[model samples]
Target: MKQEPSYIEALLPILTLVGLLTMNVFFFEDTLAGSNQVALLLAATIAGIIVRRNGQAWARTMENVVSTIGSAMPAMLILLLIGSLAGTWLLSGIVPALIYYGLDIINPRVFLITAVVVSAIVSLATGSSWSTIATIGVALLGIGKAIGINEAIVAGAIISGAYFGDKISPLSDTTNLAPAMAGTDLFTHIRYMLYTTTPSFIITLLIFLVIGLSYNFSEAVVDVANVKSAIDGAFNTSPWLFLVPLILFVIIIKKVPPIPSLMIGTLLGGVCAVLFQPHMVSEIAGNVPNYAEASYIGFMQAMFGDIIIVTPDADVNELLHTSGMAGMLDTIWLILSAMVFGGIMESGGLLTRLTQPIINWADSTGSLVASTVVTCIFFNTTASDQYISIVVPGRMFRKSYQDKRLKPEVLSRTLEDSGTMTSVLIPWNTCGATQSRVLGVGTFDYLPYAFFNLISPLMSILFAYLNLKIRRYELDEIPVEERIN
Candidate 1:
């Protein structure tokens, strides 16, 4: 690292991060738990050291870190709340009950389409792809596999649905993050993204449906007996228990802060446990001589920490588990490290350097759209962090879009199309690894099936070249298929 550097020179730390993380993903895959996070931290440290050597106060570097984390606190809180919400929802029967009902209705022949459609409905309803995935996506993966649909296709369908929500739902972090970074607001970003997102998503759904119709799925619908029995034996699964998540949903819809909303959700789940799964509370709280204290301690621990409900059936244990706030620590740490790396790149002026060429050469609207899409995908491939992918591209291209008299929405939409959607396809990306691990499918296996992802970039390019539904820099410019690329 140099003490004094030009904008291009500042990119060295970013390159170091990219190189180290790429090596870890390809050469040392799955052997290290947080190698990616450590790589980000290491990169940030190098940047800080460089700054310090240049006579910049250490306080300045530390302040940047603090500001970065501060900006991210809301997203981090939402993630943690989602973890707790997931746990309690499982305990309260919202997740498993939905899974049970879902398994019962799905036809083996249309499993792929069903996966995509159902996940879309749920994610659209909840404004959360992660929640939809963690609860329904996991169950669908198992069901789709049993139905003989390719695991990749099934995972693809799930991802497609999840990301649809991430892109369109005003509640999603990335949905919010994109506009925030671009100096645009959330609702505007979401509304504009729909221009590209809706079309690509529809095309993806059609592809899944066509594939489903073509593929032979002869396997029986999951008996759901083992899983149901496991859940039944563990928690008192009932419709009344659904109130927990229903209330939680209401709170989220009301736009309460995530921390408070999650706290309420956890408490309600514990209350439901007391009413329905008291024995579970007792078991989780551990044995004690006193009844009330044992119940209180056990329920509290289950709410704030780890709780596992034992069933005579092994499958029940898998479903009836919660890590509460603790479960989110790893993901949170990863995001923080990623932010550090991102902050360094931003502060060091490396992110600006990375996209300068595209910004300079994108003369036509078509080339501009293509350039934005390509740059976002490039960041996903090179930066190895989706947040970086979005943040860097959004920041770099903001001026270019405005210079051309295009609305910020265009750039924001392009960011989601190329940045958010493609991140899951890269094996080294955090989204890729997490989803792959969660669904028990490798990124390679799922890449082809991720039709929306595989196809969206193409769609973006096609739209750019054809100028179909393409708005102009001037609002008065007629929307039509214009010059072809």
Candidate 2:
């Protein structure tokens, strides 16, 4: 006896959520911690009330919310592992070695460009933009500050490069998830993405290069040697420490599952800490007489708790801390809250109702792609989670793309172009909150500089409008009855 809710009822929850979020942002500014989570819960409750009034059982709605949150368990586990990996890597000398080496090779004039390139390389190898930002991204931020560069610009370049790699890397969850949701394979999605991704990345790199070269170093001389010395003194900076990341890369390249790969990487980081950074581990252990016991205590603490590595240099000290798995809880909370809201909308048919108008307006291939992009962005803004943004539009548009004789890769690429990249641009989204906490940069402060993210959706639309590489399946590949003229 379930009845569909009216369009106004469907729209009310979204409007309420938006209004609350705007007020939260305006009043709290950078300190709007947990406000949006509350907003999402309130929105979900409002949606539930409307759906119940329309004859949908409250039990069924709660069931959908639980099921939706359950589906996100893998992502939650990955977030925890990433936090553990960051802690162990910092304790071990792997992260310090990277910073020490990166500082040595980079000149002030080219530092911004180098930051982008280095971040891109790391994210590509690990297939994790979050890990890249938490680790090397933090060290680069310190280095940039010491060299008199704007922190906001540094964060922008770092994010731009990290997300570029995340978009294309086979090991990325979003890359895998996008294709799975859009009815395509991972490699095919990546291959199709290159048509727009490559050009956008090249343009982004060129812009960073120009910005790097324009920096005037005479006014603010960087003391690279001093920073290196501090890092070396604080940890055992050596090339041997790189074996940890090398093993991680090898496991990823071998197509091992991400959870296992990150677990192995975390364990390797602990071993490296024990072997190469015994003194630091002992210090973290605090009063343990046995080295073996100290190593155990140190590694356990780093895996599950928080640790701060104090250095003589104040700037370097800020860069040398990790909150382990506990730090990821806030982000996990945000994701769960968002899932509840999205689940309510989905179960109530609100998302379908909201998306119908946009889908109906897609008369041509170009218009179709544009509408998909806009829908993805809209979800990112209103849904406040990247995964929801991807999943919802992807589900809504799958049949539309197939009906239009477009390939599944087109839908997948559009999801990533608008959904994945734009998530970090919004202050209330889970990606934005996690990254801002990790990199110590606000979303708005770095939004203007994330050139790759800003350009990706536009690039997708441009390719569609220009009829460039918009691959459709062979006419014979379509069913006779379903094929459109």
Clashing pairs in 1: 285-298
Best by lDDT: 2
Report the lDDT of model 2 for residue 342: 75
Candidate 2 Cα errors over 4 Å, as ranges: 29-33, 108-112, 118-198, 210-223, 363-369, 376-416, 419-450, 462-485
lDDT of 1 at 39: 78
Worst 10 residues of 2 by lDDT: 217-226
Q: How accurate is candidate 1 locally (lDDT)?
A: 0.68
Error of 2 at 300 (Å): 1.3
Candidate 2's residue-wise lDDT over 1-485, tens digit each? Answer: 88877779888987887777656655654322577778788988998898888888888888878876776676677778877887898899887787677655565677787777777765765467877787667777877876677889999999998898788875465776687557665556777898999999999989988888877653232444666778989987888887878887677667676678889989999999999999999999995999999999999999889889887776566557778888767667766787788778878887667767877888888898999888788877865667667766775677689877798899999999999999999888767877898888999999999999999999999999888998787767975533322
lDDT of 2 at 46: 94
Candidate 1 residue-wise lDDT, 1-485, digit = tens: 43444555566676777787777766555413677678778887877766666566666666766766666676566666656665555555565565555445566777777777767755654455655777668878887777677788889999997777666754355765676555444555665666667788888878888888977777654434565666665656677766766786677667665567667877786677667766655666676767688668866675567766666755445545667667767657766776676666555555556657666687787898888888788878886767667766675676666666666666777787888889989887767877888888999899988888777777767777776765446755522321111
